[model samples]
Structure formats: structure tokens, C-alpha cells
Target: MEESPAAARWRVPPAQTALKCAAAAVFAVLAALSDEPGGLLLAAVATLGSGGLALRDLLAPVRVAADPGAVTVVTGFAGHRTLTWPEVLDVGTDERRRFLSTTRLLEIRTDDDLYLFSAFDLGADVREVADELDRLRAGGPRS
Candidate 1:
């Protein structure tokens, strides 16, 4: 089913989610086959970490969603936090340059905290998402 025309949502893409699950599966196999104690411990840790992340992503697929009234985001471990338009102080993009690469992130600022999301987290370009958020915050049309 399609989302309502009044709201827009974004999530970790299905392919990326599948890749995370696959990595977890590989880690599980490695954990099972590891004979050395150190190797087994390492693999077990990897399995649990990746598996937990995959489960979280699967459970809360929509990382970010916004409507005319409020913006909702998936927070820690499948939890969700909703901020009304009034609570949202700013919607913008941040860029960090490291070595040869630059990372762009969508940032939502509030009185209490600043929430940042990567493209992987939003399943869309950070700039586009920020622009959409700005439009929504301004009571513009949803596109």
C-alpha cells in the first residue's frame, strides 16, 4: 500500500537491510566453525552485534517520516521519537570531510538534542531529505 499523500517516509533500503542480515548470517557460520577460543569469541561477538542491528532495522524500517504536523524518527533499539513542528528548531544537512571522502548527513535540531541521520539511515540522499523537511516545516506541498 502507498503512504498517505500528506506524509513522507524514508528507511534503510531493503537491499542494504538484506546485506546486513547476510553479514550476520556469515558471522553466525563463522562462529559455528571457529575452533580456536579467540576466533570463536570474535565471531560470536560479530554475530550478535550484526544480528542485533539487522533485527532493529527490520523492526523499525522507517527511520524518518514527516507530515504537516510533526516529524517522527526511529530512535534507539526500535524506539520512536516524535517531534511536533514547533519542537523542531531546524532541519538541515551537515557535511564532514575526512581524508579523501566527504560524508553528508541530515540533521534535525531541537531544544534538547540534535539528531543526525546518514543516507543509509534515511535510505535517501541527505540533501533531498533535508529539503523535503524544510518544505514540510514551512507548510509547503508534499512532493
Candidate 2:
């Protein structure tokens, strides 16, 4: 189906998805090559974990989508939660500092929940996403 011109979508980048898949493959190979039962178990667990994550990303790549009516966000594996524009109390950015590094996140606040999406999660700059969301919310031109 074709999305409306007012809609915006974001997802995990293909490169990151490929990296997860690659990690899963490497773990699978390790599992096949391991001689010790403990090593085999570890590799098997890693393989399953990474493989599941990769599959999830591949199947449900769109992490966030917003349109004139509402905003939908992936809440779990193949699951989504949508909040109408009226339910959205605020859209902004937050900074997280850990030691020498700082991470920016897009935050959406609703009546009962606060959703945060990182740049990696949205596959775009947090600031840019925030600006777009603001414009969309304000019924301004997307450009």
C-alpha cells in the first residue's frame, strides 16, 4: 500500500541489520565447530539470540511511523502501539550521558507512557526526527 505524503517512517538501517545477521552466522559456525559441550551450548545460545534479533529486524523494519492522524511505534517483536495526535502530549529529544559519551534520543510523551528512540533505532538523526515530528504535529509543511 502507498503511504500518504504526510506520513514519515523510520527503521533500523540495512547495514546494521546485515551486521546482526552476520553475527548470527558467525555464532552458528562456532556452534558447529565447537568440540566442548559448554562452548557448543554458548555458541548455540548466541546464535539463537542474534538470529532472532536479526529476523525480527528484517520482518519488522519500520520502528516508527507518523502521519496526520497518529504515530505508530514498534513496541515488541512484530507488535506496534499507535497514539493519536491528540494523545501525544509532547515530542522532544533527551540526552543521556555515560562517562565521556553522550547519546541523543527522540522522546514521545503520552498520557500514560514515554517512548524513547535513539538515532540507531530511527536510522536518522534524533534532532532531525524531532524537527520533522514537530512540523508534522503542527500541521506545517514537511519540507
Candidate 3:
């Protein structure tokens, strides 16, 4: 038997989307019930805009899915970017230490540009993701 080429598919938690939708609904209802037009309008706009962004995230999440053919990058609403093994030039990590915490990001460099993927958004360690991507890019096993 042979394994399918489809490697991994990363997506944001659905709870995040649900929370955003709930917030939007709450704000809209509050605005409708409020007597103050200015505050109502402000609340309505903020909530709706936030909801739209969240919905977009749900629809098209930031994911890096690699297969035998190519690696696909979906950056919520930004569209898809595909890179073949040869096109995946390099994979690295970025770390930033703040006042009390640190942040890590996975960086992918190609022939023409560089892309950054956040571990937080992927719900995985940046190093792990980078390693897997590097392996796939090098024509190694998907596992």
C-alpha cells in the first residue's frame, strides 16, 4: 500500500470563529436596543468588522499543507501560494524576546520572497513546523 500525498492541513480553532460571531450578534442586538444612535453605530461597525475578519479566518485559515507535489500556503483571504520542493529554498525560525515573554515564528524563503508563519496561529511549535517543512522541501518522508 502507499500513503496519500496529502500531508497536513492546519486550521484555526472553530471556537475562535464562534466567539467572534457571538460578539457580533451581541453588539448588533445591543445597538438595536440602544437609544443613543452614535454609540450604537460605533458598536455596530466595530463588531461587524471584527466578525467579518473572523469569518474570513474561518473560511480561509492560515495553513501550510505540504504534499508530494507542492506546499500550499493559505493566508486568510490573501489567497493561496504554492511552492514546489525545488522552490522551497530555505526554512528558518524567528524569535523575539519581549519585556516578559517571547514569540517564535517560522520563516520560509523561496526564490523570490519570504513568508512568515506564526506558531500561535498554527497551534504548533514553530521549530516542529519548520522542521517538517524543511524535510518535505528536501524530498524526505512526509511523516
Candidate 4:
């Protein structure tokens, strides 16, 4: 049987998380090994601190199986943002970051709310994923 599109909604790619953890470990070691070493203990601390945040953000996505009635962006996560999709009204990119730089923003509108989501907090597949979100809000398939 085919899985429903709702069952295939966006979630962070698992390998991404593992890879981040591994990269952090590698960096901690390399940093600690440098001529001007960050110090083994300091590197370890840094790795743990950042790894925790990465893991948290990696798991912060709660809409992997279906789009909400509307999108809601809760920016005050103790560490990460929480997003609900059905309320999102528009998404756009701005070159304000620099002459060649752009930022993605998701503008949401609800019966009594408005908010925006930025690309800065997102990862590699941002364009494709954000496009899907756009289609979803427009009442269409992820295509």
C-alpha cells in the first residue's frame, strides 16, 4: 500500500543528525590537537554543548506526518523554533544579508495571528522543503 503524503511530511534527515554529532566529535579532537590547542577539556565541553543544541534542534520538528490547519512559528524555544504549517501565508527570500546573500522567510497568517520563519534556522534541503510547504498551504500536493 502507498503511504499517504501526510505520512511523508518533512522531518530532519536522520543522517544529518548523526553526521553533525560525528563532525562535532572530530572537530573537538582536531581543535584540541592544534598547535594552539583549544585544550582537550575545552574541546570536549564545546562538543557536548553544541552537540546538545544540534540534537535538540534536530528533533524539534513535530510535523513529520501532516500539515497543521495553519502554520505557527514559535520563536521562543528554550533553544529552537517550533513551526506549525497551516497558518503560513507566504514565503520569500531577501538579499538583505549581502549583495549575493538572501534569506528565506515564511510569513504566516491565522484568524488572529501572524509570524515569520527564516532560512537561517533551516538546513540544506531548505528550498525543496520550503516549496513543499508553500504548495501545502496553497492546498496542493508537495509537487
Cα lDDT tens digits, model 1, 1-143, are 11477778988888888988999999999999999999999999999998998998899989889888999987778999999999999999999999999999999999998988999988789999998888877888766
**What is the C-alpha local distance difference test score of each model?**
0.88, 0.88, 0.74, 0.51
Ten consecutive residues with minimal summed lDDT in candidate 4? 63-72
Cα displacement (angstroms), candidate 3, residue 3, comes to 10
- Each candidate's TM vs. the true structure? 0.95, 0.90, 0.78, 0.51
For model 4, what is the error of residue 49's alpha carbon versus the real structure, in angstroms, after optimal superposition?
Answer: 3.7
Off by over 4 Å in 4: 1-3, 6-8, 27-41, 61-68, 72-89, 95-125
lDDT of candidate model 2 versus the reference: 0.88
**Pairs in steric clash, model 2:** none
| Winner on TM-score (1 vs 2) | 1
The TM-score between candidate 2 and the true structure equals: 0.90
Best by TM-score: 1
Candidate 3 global lDDT: 0.74
Residue-wise C-alpha lDDT for candidate 4, range 14-42, written one tens digit per residue: 66667777878886776668665347667
RMSD of each: 1.6, 2.3, 3.5, 5.4
